[model samples]
Target chain A: MLKKPPSVVLASFRPSTYPRGYASALHSLRPCWMVFLNILILIVVCGVSSAVVLAEDHLAVPANLQVFDTPNDGGQSLTVNWAPGALDSPDVRYQVLVGDAGATDVAALKVVAEFPAHTRLVKDAKGAWWTRTAERNWHQFTIRSGKAVELKDGTVYTVTVAMLKGEERIVGPLLQAAPTPNWFNWNLVNNLVLTLIFGGVVFFSIAHARRRDIFLRRIPGLDAVDEAIGRATELGKPILYLTGAHDMSDPSTIAAAVILGRVAKKTAAYETELLVPHRDPITMAVCQEITKQAYLEAGKPDLFKEDSNFFITSDQFSYTAAVDGIMLRKQPAANFFMGSYFAEALLLTETGASTGAIQIAGTDSDHQLPFFVTTCDYTLIGEELYAASAYLSREPVQLGTLRGQDIGKAMILSVIAIGILLATLGVATQAAWPQYFLDFFKDVK
Target chain B: MDATIIGAWVATGLTLFIFSFLYKDNPLFKLAENLYVGVSVGYTIVKTYDTVIVHLIWKPIVENQEWTLLIPVAIGLLMLTRYVPKAAWLSRYAFAFIVGVGAGLAIPRTVSSFILKQIEDTIRPLLMLVPGEGVTFSWNLMNPASSVNVIIVLIGVSSVLFYFFFSVEHSGPGKMVARTGVMFLMIAFGAAFGYTVMARMSLLIGRLTDLIEYSDPSYGRPTLWLTLVTIGTLIVLSRRSRSEPPDSH
Candidate 1:
């Protein structure tokens, strides 16, 4: 058909001239022209840097994923294995990622394991990485799944593996696996040895705890808590307790919690005020529980003022300042420093010493002990803090656990002596006993 | 190189000011201690605002628009209720949540990492002499260690574990085991104690080294000026404090 003249077409366009209206025609035509222009731009842009961006964003999963049992847990965990990505990093590492279902976006990925480049060999398989890949065609990675994760019983759940080059791109063809309960995970071999030792300690201790006269030695540092409290009561002043700066998650802080229980009880019985300044909010909460329990046990629950235990700042130095401020203001007659401490240990102890408070410090932090020893009236050495709960609570479970630890220590000593003998013998006669003896500690590849 | 250097100087001055405590109670030490405390608290407040409030709370709630975070947000708010004495007990609910969650997390991890992992690493075959290997026996190429080292490691790990075991009776075989454990425990303790002593000595040495290093002109004639200024200031302050009545607690 011949095209109409532009002027004629325009002049004919009265409001009612065209039944289907000019607006739709204009709208449709403009978008088509704009889309064409966009296509041209995209083609040019893609042509310029297509290779680089494609290389950066390319992700793939290896074809095969092997699932197996993990050791120690009560039949819950699985170790997953995957082939390494095709373009795996020379310098960086592969992070094993997992999710509940396939087709889930990569953003919701869970990190299963991070394997260093040098230590790529799995404990179960003894072959070299090259040989293993030749035989199985799958590079191995281990994922530990606890009882907490439940993929549908019979349904297939997708597993994806990605290699992260530090904080950069996660490159992979995502692997998918349908996890079934595996009969054996070769990793369990190592776990089996550990379980035996743990059971041995617990078993022997529990058997020993049955005896009537198990002589537990006195820890002078722990024994002085009472004396410290007594002195504070005599001086007509409050007792201050700092449970270190760490949250209750720290073992040292837990030890502090246990010590606090004893101190709280003693303070309650003596009708002396107890002041606990905390650095962590969680620890402050734990201390409150311990204090209440102590007061309740002492039959003075009413005297237990919750506000006496305060949450200071969570910052290390700030917490130190706040506690020091309290000490300078109150001049508490006795200070109990327990749990884990850092640089603040010196600062707090010095302030306490200056105030003439009889400070009893207990912590597993070796670095802080010098300051504690120099300034505090009494200090618990390494592991002494761990012993406090057993001393105070006398719980068989706790006591049993300690006994296990003791047994474990004894076995270690006997070996050390034997090893020393072998070393000396080898030196004296140029024998190979040291080398022979040292072989046992090596990791089974 | 900029504020870090100035900060280092400030830190050095403060450290010396505090160390002056070893000689005698002094005002310069108190001033440094107070400034340290104030600045540290300020730093913490800023960090907590940036991390816990911003990252853990506000980002998740507002930026991510995750409404479920309201529970934690409410609990965090309850923790601040301590400023109000009457409603202070309300904070316990927050405390309970934190403690409960923490315990739940810790027990399983502790059981696995420390207790289970330690035990797993300890036990080994009583005899690791692999037959038909060699005249003297060889280290297992498949495993990390030779047989003898395995036994020694097992012994070390078990004995150490035993020494800390406090619940059982120390009699008969138990006594024998306990005694062996104690000796092992002592040696380990000794080693640890020795290392600790070394570490503390190092720190003392480090502090002294820094003090000496400050004598160099390149870093500035810091030691001389710092010592003289701090001493002079302390002397003045001590005399003033003596003349004035002590601040009552």
Candidate 2:
């Protein structure tokens, strides 16, 4: 049908038969005044509403919703991640909903966490770049064992995300995830790489030392070992040795035990008495074996006493008091304090000093080093304590290990120099590259 | 008297006995020392039983049906095999396992936290650019994170590390570096020694406070009585020692 001319239509806008001017004008514009235009407007409004209803029903909420066990973790954790949607903003509310596996009803799921959509994004996570599970533009929420959630390991759970914009709530697809314990945390790959490098360096050094002489600077404390032993033999006084207050698990304790072997051998050869008092029973047991082996090696098995490496109490001050008693009573000509010591360092060393014994101490405990140095005639500080066994034994393996550690320190020094230079230059030039260099030394997890 | 008051009296007497050792090795000091050793060993045994046996091994196996706890229990039993000389060789298995696992765990963690983290912290930028201003070197000594402190740390770390380098002998320039390292070490040790002296002084203050508290009339003046007894005992012991032959020791 042909539409009416604008002039006729305007002229037809007049008062109707029933009402006042305003209502009559509105009445004339619809119904028959402009039939085709009115019909077209109705169709457009209906179509738009229909399309909106369809979109609300079918369009996915919080795009690309995924659920998986949190990686690089022990277990009992599940992560829900989704791509950032248009609705994400500071004003909009986002929530993490978790339920038993195969649970489809969103109403049944408990909301573990709820916050503004702009927070908890992938970029907010701490650690190295590779530690992030998703790209910067995604939102991540973790469900772990806490007051809000108790996710059991190896049990599947369904997870979903919900977004609230005003009164409208959109729920995402239900996804299943199981919290399984991981054997190795991939986040510490950098740590693994460093350990491997150091291991390779150590092994290579060991091999090289076996082939040729590796020059190790003289450690005076280690050099004094023999002199101390000889002094004990000359005085006819028993040599008193303490392995400190750690178990056999500690590296310092192990070194002390090895040094005990060397000392025991010399003591047996000289037929000078040896007294070793231990705080840990396990260490006492091990040292007994070491002392026995040393005597056997020196062909003085008959002189080796089972009571020599005896267990004292594992108490710090009590053990120190007991050792002090021994020092005063027996009056050992020489005192060897090795391994890690605590506050009792001064108590033992001072007592030994007062007894006029030739005191020699080797320990990595920096806090107690001052006491050892002040009271003892000879003190091995820091790594020197670790190197004492190697220096005394002169064995290829021990020598190589020392050389390897030295090389490792050198490598570390080189890295520090290079990193500082790069970092300084980056700051001056306003470059993004230096952080990558720094990240190499950063602990990933 | 109440148990707390009695405990105070006993503690005061023991403290006085121990203090007698400062004068000379006497019977009182020896008695106190032996008692201290005995009580500490007893405490350790009880603590080990409670923690290892009841909590770690027994509770888990009974409550949670955690059979995995048995493995560690078995290993611990293997460690006890050392008492049997013939079976003593078996204890090496336990030791080996412990050392291997400990080293494996320690190496990675040490590398991560001790080595890597320390290196990262040491290698920081000497300069920083402030917004709307040019690059700047912070000279604020009060701020530990400032560039001046950073430079000091750099020198300290490098010199100390160089000193520990065993392969290179401390000679010529190496000797200079080693000397610088020694200076730094002495400074560090001196500072630590002073700090520890303060700590020890505090400990002494704590002990003195206890002694003073025990000397109150409500506690029956245990500290004063104990001190008199200790002094008398020391004098008698010294007299006896002087009377004895010099070759008796």
Candidate 3:
């Protein structure tokens, strides 16, 4: 026969119903025994009820767990997602667990991520699913933080999502995923499409440009270049040109080289002395070829000096010091600071300014634009530097590239306009379609 | 007496010598400048040898037994053929490979990071001011500052893009938009200039703080001693230049 606990048995029994001898003995012990028994009963009742309440509070396991390799990545990540259980509460959280594939032991799994409850709602969601859903509830919680960095590529992994309340947890069924290296990232499909479209437009424009004249706007900076060269010629002083601080690989440096060709041709025609100092050896070699070509094109190849384009130290400040020395000593009538520059920009420009040289600078470096604008007589800001090269060269390919860039900008503007209109319509009428229309612009990843 | 103190003194002297160029391009400034250039070139050569020759090429091939790396190693060695008059054309192959690979790699990344990201950022809804909030509009327009900012940004981006459009001539209405674009560009340039000025000033403050620290007695007043020596050297060089005849160009 089973016996109840001492506290429960004591509560059910009474001393009065016992025999006279037993009753007399019990009377003496009744006062103290009843007090001790009452305290023990209270302690046992509280402890048992609290444990039961804690067991009841344990959250239900998350349902419909899914794991897969993250698409359009370098095979370094996996995404785990789960649907919330019916018993999920605000106080409960979900933790994603990862283990080797076919691993059934929950204790062996490692927690990859922990997500607080009620955090599944898309706050700034522009997706069609997010907009169309009337309940405004997330269908599944996506946990991208479950990336297995140490896991080898092509190795399979199992994932589980556990609903947690305090120390108690209930884990969902395991899901398997394998990360494999992808040759091409499909996530950047929009980027690929735009690049192809833009590239096609450029090639078409280039072909068209060869057959006809392309109308290019008057860049004020190009005229200034000619004027500065004329001023240097009239003053019987040399014209100084810098091909910036970058190597030949930089786009800005290439543009600078193109511009240098145009300047060299004019200088050769005028028979004005030209000095070109370079910071990069490769750029120096390329500029030498460009200068020689320009002189040959101008039919003044004999006047081309090999020493005109020479390399200075590649150290930024040292190069700046050398250029500043040239500016002070040579005191060139015209100084051209073209291409990219950093903090040393102001240092060189300030020295050029002190020499009273007619300075013309062109650069896509916005940070250096201010110093050039204040110190130089004429400044080509940002894209104008690239534009000046195309304008000067009148190359069909360069012109075509510029035209393609403009078209790309137009496409972006049209997209923005459509997005704005849709957003306005969505807000005014409280409809889902307009919001869905805006979803195309959102970066899904 | 200590090596660190001597090093600090030397650095302080070199710094002061370089700074003396602000007074005039003297011989001391030239000395310091040349020293900096020589040190920098030497450092670059050592680093390039370690990274390119030792680590990237030799270690991978020798340690990992990656014999396939010899193809790139051969291509790299071909670049040195430029120094040989007869085999100079061989370097063109290396240049072509480098330029081709660089362009192929850069085009996609540049399109994604610069072009697409810029377009994505610009394609935001103009009406939605605060993030994750309903579209806000005010009759006063300026009452909600964020809406006004959004309008300004949209206008700025459109006008600037219009300015760069070459197909259309800027004649009547186009000229007005182009001029507005110029104004925006100028404002951006002005802001950039202000930022550069702040950055330069910060650098100046950093240098000045170092000078002040070096002037402390614990460092044997290296800055003060270096400043005096640089001034004396510059003065002597200026006197010598005055005494000599000017060179004919």
| Model 2 C-alpha lDDT per residue in residues B44-145, reported as the tens digit of each score | 999999998899988999998999988888888888888898998888888888777766766787788778888978988898676776898989899877
Give the Cα error of residue A95 in candidate 3, in Å: 1.7
Query: Which tens-of-lDDT digit does each residue in A18-105 have in candidate 3?
Result: 5666455458877687778777776777777777667656676665566777655677567665554555667778787788887889
Best candidate, DockQ-wise?
Answer: 2
Q: Which candidate is the best by lDDT?
A: 2
Candidate 3 runs further than 4 Å off: A1-58, A84-90, A120-149, A270-274, A300-307, A429-445, B128-135, B138-145, B240-249
Candidate 3 lDDT (Cα, 0 to 1): 0.78
Q: Please give the RMSD to the true structure for each candidate, in Å.
A: 21.6, 7.7, 10.0
lDDT of 2 by residue, A1-445 (tens): 1133344444544644654544744665575746676456656656766777677544248888889999989999998889987656787888899999878899889999999988888867755665677887799888898899798998989899998877778898888999988998887887888888888999999999999999989988888999999999999999999998888777788889999999999999999999999999878888998999999999999999999999889999999999999999999999999999999999999999999999999898889999998999999898898898888888999999999999899989999999999999998988867777777788767
| Residue clash pairs of candidate 2 | none
Backbone clashes, candidate 3: 0
What CAPRI grade goes to candidate 2?
A: medium
Candidate 1 residue-wise lDDT, A1-445, digit = tens:
1132333434433344444554674765764666576566556555555665576456444435555443322343445566545555556566666676555677676666666533354534543222233224345654544553454434444555565555665535544555455455343343345456766886788677666334566667778888889999998999999888678667788888988888898899999999998777678876887899999999999999988898766678657756776787788999999988887787798889999999899887766676677788888765778887777666666676666666655654565556545654564455654644533322322
